[model samples]
Structures are given as structure tokens and as C-alpha cells.
Target chain A: MRNRKMAALTTVPYVIWMALFVVIPLVLIVVYAFTSKAGGFTLQNFSAMGDYAKVFARSLWLALAATVICLIIGYPVAYALSKMGPSFQRTAIMLLMLPMWINFLLRTYAWMSLLENTGLINTFFDNIGLFDLINKIALSLASDPSAYQPIDHFQMINTQGAVILGMVYNYLPFMIMPIYSVIVKIDRSMIEAAQDLGADSVTVFRKVIFPLSLPGVLSGITMVFVPSVSTFILSKLLGGGMNMLLGDLIELQFMGGAYNPYVGSAISLVMMIIVMICMTVMNRFGDGEDQAVML
Target chain B: MSEKLINLENIHKDYGGKVVLDNINLYVRDKEFVTLLGPSGCGKTTTLRIIGGFETPSAGVVYFDGKKINDLPPHKRPVNTVFQRYALFTHMNVYDNIAFGLRIAKVSENVIKDRVTNMLKLINLPDYAKREVSSLSGGEQQRIAIARALVNHPRVLLLDEPLGALDLKLRKEMQRELKSIQQQVGITFVYVTHDQEEALTMSDTIVVMNKGKIQQIGTPVDIYNEPKNAFVADFIGESNILDGVMHKDRLVSFCGKNFDCLDSGFEKDETVDVVVRPEDFEIVPIEDAQLVGTVKSTIFMGVHNEIMVETEDFTWKVHSIYNAEVGDKIGLFLTPDDIHIMHKS
Candidate 1:
């Protein structure tokens, strides 16, 4: 009885903290989502959400593309890192986490300068006569060479691809860390057992290694997808305020030209619900197995 | 006699200047249950792995069915292994774990179901087809590991201390079960274990090893009754080894007394080691005692009393059904056949 009381006492601070920061904010958001600017109950905020449908679609699509690309690039790197010697693995993991120590905004700003029209990449391309080579090929293929305008610098920044590249560059280490930790902890005898039972390398991987690493893959997808979907700064800085996402639209309602907290609260609630639904569906794939559900 | 199925010729294994196995030559016959018995770090498991194609000998060739299989990978070898910890795939059900090899070989689903069902029945877990691997107990997982390897019908089955993780009662039960399973399948089995009792209970041929060298290889009775040296005698069971001198054809001198023994092929006054099992001593009256001493300690060991007799030169361990109080005078007698003489190693 004394131990139980002590445990309950220890949890009081955390409970108070949650109530102050989390519960009250969630309650206030729900209240604002259902009320108008004049403090009267109304559903006008939700009815007005139809105007930002394209923003929602663009946010979800870019996040999904970035997540898929991260998985494609991260899985093999994690697998290779897991196979290295212990000292090498320690060094490699340190290198992977080194970039995360820098400020997130600073990293994204670095990408901004690198991807500008007169950036280092475009300068290098110009120095190598890459633009001339491309124009020559276009001239050779065109039926009307005079109508074709000569190409100058590649339009890399201020595009959806640049925003995705920023997200992927920032979040890839998150994907690889969990997968590498999981793969490194797998028992060595399991692979030996598979081979002893007449499984070749590919068959052993398909049957044993990949299935056991599903929980890690699921967690990696979550870590990369959640922040990418709700990010406004990357799209603003890299996409140059043109391809606005759901986060930017929500920010505009509260702090931009439109200053209505009711519509902002409604969009925030909808995005949270959609993300929760996506997570629920993803966790269904890991139903009977052991999974690390971060939420 | 059955034909020789596996031959390890002049095998030597070293790991970065440290020798793990030294000049080992062994062979296993078809349908014979062979055990490599030793303590930890004695290279018994390394020998078994070499035969299973998990390790390649540093200097020798491995022959499987009269063909050199030194370079063959484990997947191409017609052998399967039950690992020490059972290593079951936790993501798979019992049915899927057992059917893994068959599926890898691309056997049809109908045939795989039949074989898997038969293997489950053989391992006495017939209704556990849908049970997860994590839900099974240690013994149940051990049986499933065996069933998984056996479902492929490999020519040889290698077991590396498969029962080392179980309790005493469960290990005993699994020992008999593994023996019967090996007999029923009629496949060559190469088992590695450090437990002398388990090796004696299951193996048809026991290869006693120590310090990366084979001490002796024989039947269980021969290994127990006629150990090659003092190390073998002490390792297999409780025995009192003493330094002695072989004075003549049938006489040995130890504890400042000469005794008649059954062994005779030693030179005159040649120094030797003598072994006498603790249970071979009989409690006799002090008047008719060949050797007499005062009892130092007595322990009740369920089936017998273990008494320590402190003589003038040596403290002897003797097992007898009769009990004696500590510090009491006692006598011990031994027959001529009970005194085993061995060369000093």
C-alpha cells in the first residue's frame, strides 16, 4: 500500500503537466473548431475546408513520395551497416547522427542555397557546357529549330521536387536508425537455422530477415511520414510560397492575411484525424507480430 | 556393418593463431548415432560444424558419401542442424517454420502440408500447426526445431547441444525422445554435447574429447569401464585417480602397499596412474581391511552414502550403501578387477 501511494505521488507532476499543456490545448482546439469568431456555436469552419482541398492533396502526395523514396534509399544502407564490424558500425552510426546535431532550419537553408538557379550545381553544369549539350540535342530533335528557345539554367528550386528533396534529406537518418538497430539485434542463429534447413541467401532473406524487420520498417515509415505531411517551412523556403501545403494553409488562417483561429483549428483537427487513420491502417499490417507503435 | 557415410580427414582448425581443433580424424557410419562429448572450448561443436558444412577445416578435407565436400555451402549439403538455442523463427507459425525448407525447394503446397503434418505428428505436437513460435515452451520449441530440420529428409542430422537449455527432468525426457527419433528415422546423427550422461544415454559411439584432441572413441560401456587415461576416467564419472608404480606383471604399488591387479603389460617398476571408481569399494571389518582409515565426512546421496576416508598418504572418496559417522575408523576392500592401471600421460 505504501509503494502504491509512492508510485501515485510520483506520477502527479506528469499528470499535471499533461493536463496543462496537452489536454487543455486539445480542448481549446476542439472548442474553436466548433465555434465562430463571435463566440457562437457554428459548423461554418468545416464547411469552409473545401476551399483547401488541393492543398491537402498536395501535402499528402508529397509526403507519400518522400516517404517511399526514403525507404528505397534507407533499407539497403541500414542492411549494409548492420553487417559491418562492431567498431565500424559504431563509427558509421555516429556519422549518420552527426547531421542531426545541427539546427533543422540551418540544414534546410543550406539546401536552399544549393538548389537555387545560380547555385553551385548549376554553376558546375554551366562550366561543363551541359546546357550547350542539352540545347544541341533539342535542336537536333526539333522540326522547328527557330521556334525553340535556348535553355539557360535548370529550374530546380521553387518546385515540389525541391520540397520533397529537403524533407527526404532531413528525415532519412530517422528511417535508417530504427531499421539498423532492429537488424543488428536479430539473433545470428536464426540465419544459420534457415541456411541449415536448405535455404539459399535470397530465400533466407525473403523468409527470415525481411519478415522479422517489418516492425522496424513500419516505425521508419511513421517517423518520416508524420512530420513531412504537416511541414510548412520546407515548402515555403524551397517551393517559394507557390505549392502551399495543408500546414501553410492552416498557418495562413491564424497568422497570415486571414486571421481566423476557427478555420485553423478545424484544419488541424482534420489533419490529426487523417494521420491517426493512416497510422491505424498501417499498424493493421503488423497485427499479430511485435511492433513498436510510437504513438 | 553399415557403410561409412562421413569422413573427416586430418582436420585442423585455427582461429587467428589460436588452435580450436588439432589434427582430428573421424568417421561416421550410416544409421549410426555418434556423439562428440567434451567440456566447453574443447572443439566438439567446431567438429560438428565442420561436418555440417558451417565451417571449413583449415588444413583437411571433409568427405560426404565418398565425395569431397570441403567447399560446399550448408544450403547445398544434404545435412540439417538443430541449433543450441532452438532458433525458431518468431514471425512464423509452427507450420510455416517446419515448411520453410520445403517451400524453399519449391515443393507443392499439397506435399508440403502432408510432410509438415507428418513431422508434427512425429515430434508429438500434432495440433500445434497454427500456434506461434513465441507461444511454445522451451521443450516444445526444441521439438519444433528438430521437426523443422527433419522434414527435409536430410542424409545427416547434426544437433549441437539441443537440450542444454532445458531443466533436468525435461532434458532427460528429451534425451530418450531424441534417441527414439533417431532410431525411427534411421538417419546418421552427429550430436555434440558436454553432458557425459546425455552422450552415454543416446550415442552408439561416443568420442571423448579434451583440449581440442580426441581422448578416446568407443562404445558407451567401453568408454565408461575402460577409459584411456586419468582425464577420461575422471571426466566420465566420479573416480579416485592416484599415482602408483607398476612393480610387476599383475602387481601395483600405491599408498605404500602392493596390490594385485588384473592389468599386466607394464615394465618392471614403471611409474603409472591408477584409477578406482568410488562405488567399487566395499566396507569391510577393520581386521580384514586391505586399507584402513578414519572417516572424515559422510554425505547422504539418495541411493548411496558418499564417505571420505583420510588415510595416511591420500584422502580417498568411497561410495557405499552403508553409512559411517565422521571421525570413525573404517576399512575399504577392493577386488583385483576394480583397480584400473593406466600409463602416465
Candidate 2:
């Protein structure tokens, strides 16, 4: 009885913290989502969500693209890192995590200057006559020669690709760390067994290494997709406010020209539901063993 | 006798200048159950891995069916391995795990299904095709691991301490089962183990190794009865090795007494090592004994009592069914055949 009492007492602080900061805020959001400005229950907030459907579509597709790119780039890196010697692995992993030590906004802001029209990348391209060569090809391809205009610089910033680049840059470590740790923990004997049973390198990867790394991939997707979908600052800075995402729209309802907490809460609630559904679907694909490593 | 299916010539392995195998030369005949027996870090596993193509020897050549296969990868080699830890794919079911190699080889699904079903039956887990790999017991998993490798139809099957993880009773049962499986499969088995009893029980030929060098290779009975040196004599079983000198042909002198032995070919009055197994000493009356001592300690070891007797120059270990109390005088008698002589190393 005393042990049970002590355990309960130890949990009291966490319980109080959860109730105060998490549970109460969620309850307030749900309440606000279903109420009007005058405090009467109404569905008007949800009914107005159709106007932001394009924003929702843009956010989902962009986040999905960013996540796929991260997987394509991160899986090979993690696999390679897992095969390195212990000291080299430590140094490589530290380098992968070094960028994350800086503030997230600071990192995204660094990408903005590098991707501008007169940024370092475009300046180097111009110095090499890359824009002039592209213009020459464009002039030859066009039917009317006068319609082709020579460009001085490439417009890399203020686009959806730039926002994705920012998101991928900021969230890449999240994807690689989990996958690297998981691959490193895999038993060396398992790969040897696969090879001894007449599996080549590709087949061993397809049948053993890749399937065993699914939990890490799922967690990486969750880690990268969640923030990329709801991130507002990336769209605002790199996209120059043109690619307004769901997060930006939600931000606008309460803090922008439209000061309506009701609609903001409703959008937040809907995004939460969608993210929860995506997570539930993903967990079905992962075997329950390595799922705890996500947190 | 069958043809040699695998051969290792002048095999040497080292890890960054630290030698693991030293000038090793061994061969295995077709359908022979050969075992590499040694303690841990004795290069037995390294030799096995070299045969399986997992590790290339630092300086040597490996031949499979009279062909030099030193550069061949493991997948291309006609060999399979049952790892120490089973190494089952957790994401796969039993059926898929067994059919992994077949699918990799692009075998048809119908044939894969048939082979997997047959393998499951052979391993005595006929209804376990759909069960998850994580849900099986250790011995069941070990059997599945064997079945998984055997389904590939390799000419040589390598086992690296496959029964090292089981309990005592289960290990004994698996040993018999493994021997039966080797006979049933009729393929060359290169098994590695450290347990002397396991080596004796399952292997047709046992290769004893120590310190990256081959100590002795022979049949189990020969290894036990005629160990080449004091190391093999002590490693195979309990031994009372005494430093002595050979008096003449078939005669040895130890404990200030001359005893008749079956070994010869030693120079007159040359120093030698004499090995006598604990079980070979017969307890008799003090007057009828060749040597006598007081019992220092006694241990009941399941079927027999092991007693330590302290004599004038050496303490002898004797295994007998009769009980001997500590501090009591006892007598030990040895026949000519029980005395083994070896040149001093």
C-alpha cells in the first residue's frame, strides 16, 4: 500500500502539469471551435472552412513532397553512416546534428539569402554564364525569336520550391537520426544470414534491411511531415506571403486582419484530426517493437 | 570415403596485425559431419567463416568442389550458415523466412510454397507456416533457422555454435536432433562448437583448436583415447596429466613407480607427459592398489562421485560410482590401456 501511494504521489506533479497546460487548452480550443463571438453554439466556423480549401491542399501536397524528398536523401545517408566505423560514425552524426544546434528560424532564414535572385547560388551561376546559355536555348526553342527575353538571374526565391527547400533543410536531421539509430541497432548476424542464404546485396536490402527499417522510416515521416504541414514562417519568409498554407490561414484568423478565435480554433482542431488520422494509418504499417524510439 | 567437398590450404587471418588463424589447413569430405571444437577466441569460428566466404583469409585459398573460390561472395557460394543467434527476420512470418532465398533466386511461387512447406515439416513445425518469428521458442527458432538455410540446397552447411544458447536438457536433445538431421540431409556439415561433449556426440570427425592453431583432428574415440598433447587431453575431458619419464618400450615411470603403458617410440629415460582419465581409475583395497592417497574432496556428479585424492607428488581426480569420504585413505588402480603417453611440449 505504501509503495502504491508513493507511486501515485510521484505522478501527481506530472498529472497536474498535463491537466493545466495540455488538457485545459485542448478543452478551451474545442469549446471555442463550437461557439460564436457571442458565446452561442454554432457551426459557422466550419462552414467557412471551404474558402481555405486551396490553402489546405497546398499545405498537404507541399508537406508530402518535402517528406518524400527527405526520405530519398536521408535513407542513403543513414545507411552509409550505419556502415561506418564507430569513431567515424560519431563524427558524422555530430556533423549531421551540428546544424540543429542553431535556432530553427535562424537556419530557415539562412536559406532565404542563399536562394534570392542575387543570392550566392545565382551569382555563381551568372558568373559562369549559365543564365546566358539558358536564354540562348530558350530563344532557339521559341517559334517567334522576339518573344524570348534574356534573363539576368534565376528566380529561385518567392516560390513553393523555396518553402520546401527551407522545410527540408530545417527538418532533415529529424529524419536521418531515427533511421541511423535504428539501422545501427540491427543485428550484424541478420545480414550475414541473408547473404549466406543466397541473397545478393540488393536482395538482402530489399528483403531484410529495408523491411526492418520501416519503423524508423515511419517515425521519420511523422517527425518531418507534422511540422512541415503546419509550419507558417517558412511560407511567409521564403514564399514572400504568396504560398499561404493552412497554418498561415489559421494564423490570420486570430492574429492577422481577421481577429476571430472561433475560426482559428476550428482550423486547428481539423488539422489535429487530420494529423492524428495520418499517424494512426502509419502505425498500422510498423511492427510494435521499435515504435517507442520515435519519441 | 567420399570426395573432398571443401578445402582450406595455408589459411591465415589477422585483424590489424593481431592473428586469429595461423597457417591452417583443413578439408571436409562429402556428407561428412565435421566439427571444429575449441574454447572461445580459438579461431574455430574464424575458420568456419572463412569456409562460408563471410571472411576472406589474410593469406590463403579456399576451394569448393576442387575450384578456387577465394574471391567468390557468400551469395554466389554454394554454402549456407546457421548463425549462433538464429538471426531470424522479425518482420517476416515463418513461411516467408524460409522462402527468402528461393524468392531471391527468382524461383516460382508454387515451388517456393512446396519447398517451404516441406522444410517446415522436416523441422517438425508443420503448422507453424503462418506464425510470427517472434512468437517461437528458442529451440523452435533454431530449428527454423536450420530449415531456412537448408531450403537453399547448399552443398555445404555451416553451423556456428547453434546450440550454445539452449538449456542443458534442451541442448542434449538438440544435439541428437542435429546429428539425425545431418544424416537425413546427407550434406557436408562444418559445425563449430566449444563444448567437448557436444563435439563428441555429434561429429564424425572432430578438429580441436587452440590459440589460432589446430591441436588435433581425429575421430571422437581417438581424440578421447589418444589425445596428441596435454592440451587436448585436458580440454576433451577431466585428466590427471603427470610429468614422467619413459623407462623403456611400453614402460613409464611416475610417482616413483614404474607402470605399463601401451605407447612406445620414446627414447630411453626421456621425459614425457602421461594422461589418465578420471573414469579410468578403479577404486580398490589399499593392499591391492598400485598407488594410494587420502581423499581431499568429493562431489556427486549426477551418475558418479568425483573424488580428489592427494598422494605424495600429485593429486589425482577419480570418478567412480562408489563414495569416498574426505580425509579417508583411498586406492586407485590403472590398467595399461588407460595410460597415455605424449612427448613433452
Candidate 3:
């Protein structure tokens, strides 16, 4: 009884902190989403979201592509880390986390400098005469040298690919960490058992390792997908104001000439719902008490 | 003589400059059940792994069915292992787990189905085809592991402490079941364990090992009746080991008394280690016994009473059906055959 009383007393501060910081802001957002600028309740904010359908679709597509690319790259890296010696595993994990320690904006800006038309990547490509080879191919196809003028450098920045590159660079560690944690928790005996039962390396991975690591894969997908879908900073800097995501549109609503908190709140509410739905679906894959026990 | 199923010649294993197995040579005949018995870190598991093709010896040769198999990987070798922890695939059902190797072998669908069904029935889990491995009990999982390995039909099966996780009663039950299964399958089994009783209960031949070396290799009766050294005698069962002098052939002197023993060919008055089993000592009247002492403590084991008698030179353990209280003067008697003498090691 005394322990219970102490536990309840200790939780009072946290309850107050959450109510003031989290619950109040959420309540305010919901109220503003349903209220008009003139202080009257209305549903116009939701109806207005239809005007930005293209932005929403583009954001989802880019996020999906970035997520797929991260998984392709991160899974192999995580599996390799899981198989490395303990001393090397620790050092490699530390190196993976090193990029996350820098400020997010700084990392994206570094990508920007490297990806600009005359930047390091394009300069190296120009030095290798890759642009000249493409120009030569275009000339052969067009039958006119004047029609296919060779460029000095390739344009990589101010494009959808640049934004994706930024997101994959910044959020890849989040994907790898969870997957690596799950992979490392797998028992070594299972691998030996598979081999002893006549499974070759490829068969063991496909039949044993891949299936067992699905929960971590799901968690990584959700972590990278949700954040990339909602981000506006990378799109603004690397996308060069040409491509606007839902986050950029929401920010524009509250800060532009048409300063409307109601529409901003509505967009925020919709994004939060999408993230919640995503998490719910992913959680279903990792459900049941047995999965936790196995982990 | 039956054909040799597996032969390990001069196996030496080292990990990072530390020797785990040293100069080990062992042979398993066809359809024989051989057990490597030792305490932990005794390199029994290493020897078993070497035979299983999971661990290549630093310097040695392994022959499987008269073919050199040291260069073969575990997946290529015709051997299966039941791991100590049962290592069942958590993501798979019992049927799928048992069918894993068959699927890898690309067996026909109907044959895979028939084999898996038969394996489930053999393991006594006929209705557990769809049951996930996580839901099964330890014993059930163990049976599934055994079935999974046996379904592969390897010529030799290696088990590394497969019953080390079970409780006492369950372990005993599995030991009997395993022996019967070995006989029914008629395949060679190479079992490794630190439990001496389990080794003796299930093994046709027991290889006692310690400190990366084979201490003794014999049948259960021979191992128990005549251990090769002090370590073997003490490790197998309870013993009252004492320093003695071989007065002459067939005679030893200890505790200021000379007793006739069955061993001979020792130099006169040479120091030796003498082993007397607790059950070999018969309690008698103090005046008519070979040695008399006061009982220090008496423990009532279910089948026998264990009395610790402290004589002038050493404490002796005697097991008898009769109960004796603490502090009571007791006399112990031993025959010539009960005395086992060995050169001090």
C-alpha cells in the first residue's frame, strides 16, 4: 500500500507536465481545426484541403520511394553489423550514429552543397566526361550536333531526387538502429540448427533470418516513412521552392498573407491521423505476446 | 565388427591461442550410441562439433563413412544436430520447421507431406502441425527438434547437451525415450553432455573427458566398476579417495593398516591413490570391523542412509540401508575387490 501511494505521488508531476504540454496543444489544434477565423464553428478547413491534393500525392510518393531505397540499403548494412565481431560491431554502430549527432539542417545543407549543378558531384562527373558521353549519345540519336549541345555539368540539385537523397541521408540511422537491434537479438543456435538440418547459406537466410527480422523491418519502414512524408525543410532547401510538401503548405497557411490557423490545424490533424493509422497497421504485424517474448 | 561410421583422428582445436581440444581420437561404429561426458569447459562439445563439421580442428582429420569430411561444411555433411536450447524456428510452425531441410533438398511436395506427417506422429505431436513453436512446452519443443533432425535421415546424429534444459524428472524420461528412439532408428548417435548420470543412462559407450583430454573410454559398467584415474572415480560417483602405500603385490597400506586389494604389478611401498565407493563399505560392529570411527553426520537419502565416519586419518563415506545417528561409533568393512588402487596423478 505504501509503495502504491509513493508511485502515485511521483507520477503527479509527469501527469501535470503532459497535460500542459501535450494534451492542451492537441485540444487547441482540434478546436482551431473546427473553428473559423470569425470564432464560429465550421468545416470549411477540411474542404479546403482538396485544393492541395497534388502536393499531398507527391509527398506520399516521394516518401514511399525514399523508404524503399532506405530499406534496400539499410537491411544489408544492419545484417552485416549484426554478423560482425563485438568490437567491430560497436565501432561500426558508433560511426552510423555519428551523422545523426550533427544538426539536421547542417546535414541537409551539406548535401545541398555537394549536389548543386557545379558542386562536387557534378564537377567530378564533368572531370570524368560523363556529360560528354551522354551528349555523344544524344547526337547519335538526333543526327544533329547543334540540337544536342554538351553541358558542362549535370543538374542534380533543385529536383525531387535531391530531396530524397537528403531524407535518406538524415533518417537512415533511425531505420538501421531498430533493425540491427532486432537482428542482434536473434539466437545463434537457430542459424546452426538451420545449417545442421541441411540449409545452405542462401536457404538459411531466406527461410530463417529474413522471416524472423520482419518486425524490425516494419518498425524501420514506419519510422522512416512517416517522418519523410511530413518533412518540409529538405523540400524547401534542396527542392528549391519548386516542389512543396504538405508540411510546406501547412506552414504557408499560418505564415503567408492568408494567415489562417484553422486550415493549418486541419492539415496537422490529418497528418497526425495518417501517422496513427500507419502505426496501427504496423503494430498488427508485431502483435501478440509471443513476439515480445521471442525478442 | 560393424563398419566405422565416424572417426576423429588426433583432433586439436584452439580458439585465439587457447587450446580447447587436444590430441583427441575417437571412433563411432555403425548404429552405436556414443556419449562424450565431462564437466563444463572440458572440450567435449568441441570434439562433438568437430565431428558434426561445425568446427574444423586446427590440426586433425575427420572421417565420415570412410570419407574425409574435415573440409566439408555442416550443410554439405550428412549429419544433423539437436542443439542444447532446442533452437526451434520461432516464426515457423512445428510442421514447417521439420520440413525445412526437406524443402531445402527440393524434395517432391507429396513426399515432403508424407515425411512431415510421419515425423509428427513419431514425435508424439501428431496434432501440432499448425501449432507455433513458441506455444509448445520445453519437452514438446525438444521432441520437435529431435524429429526435425531425425527426419533428415542423416547417417550420424550429434546432440550437444540436448537435455540440459529439462528438469530432473523430465530429463530422466527423455533419456529413456532417446535410447529407445536410437534403437528404433538404428543410426549412429554422438551425444555430448556434462551430466554423468544422463550419459551413463543412455549411452552404449561413454567417453569421459577432462581438461581437453580423454580420461577414460569404456562401457557404463566398466566405467563405474573401474575408473582409470582419481578424476574419473571422483567424477563418476561418490568416492572415499585416500593416499596409500602399496606394501606389496595385491596388498596396500593406509591409515596404519594393510588391506588386501585386487590390483598388482606395483613397486613395493610405492605411494598410490586408493578409491573405495561409498556403497562398498559395509557397517559392522566396532570390534569385528576393519576400521572403526565415529559418525560425524548421517543423511537419510530416499533409498539409502549415508553416514560420514571420521576415523583417525580421514573421513569415510558409507552408504547402507540401516540408519545411524550422528556421533555414533561405527565400523566399516571392505573386501579386496572393493579396493581400487592407482598411481598418483
Query: How much is A198 displaced in model 3, in angstroms?
Result: 0.5
The most accurate candidate by TM-score is 1
> lDDT of each prediction vs. the true structure?
0.93, 0.92, 0.90
TM-score of each: 0.98, 0.97, 0.96
Q: Label model 3 with its docking quality class.
A: high
Candidate 3, residues B1-345, lDDT tens digits: the string is 237788889988999999999999889998999999999999998898888778899998898888888989899988899999999999888989999889888998899999999988877789999998989999999999999999989888899999999999998999999999999889989999989898888889999999999999999989999999999999998898999999899999999999999999999899999999999998899888999999899899999988899999999988899788899998889999999999998
lDDT for residue A161 in candidate 2, whole number 0-100? 94
Which residue pairs in candidate 3 collide?
A: none
The DockQ figures for the candidates are: 0.83, 0.85, 0.84
What's the lDDT for residue A156 in model 2? Answer: 83
Q: Which lDDT tens digits does candidate 3 get at residues A215-253?
A: 888888988999899999999999997989988988898
All candidates: interface RMSD: 0.7, 0.8, 0.7
Q: In model 1, what lDDT does residue B46 have?
A: 95
Q: Rank the candidates by lDDT, best first.
A: 1, 2, 3
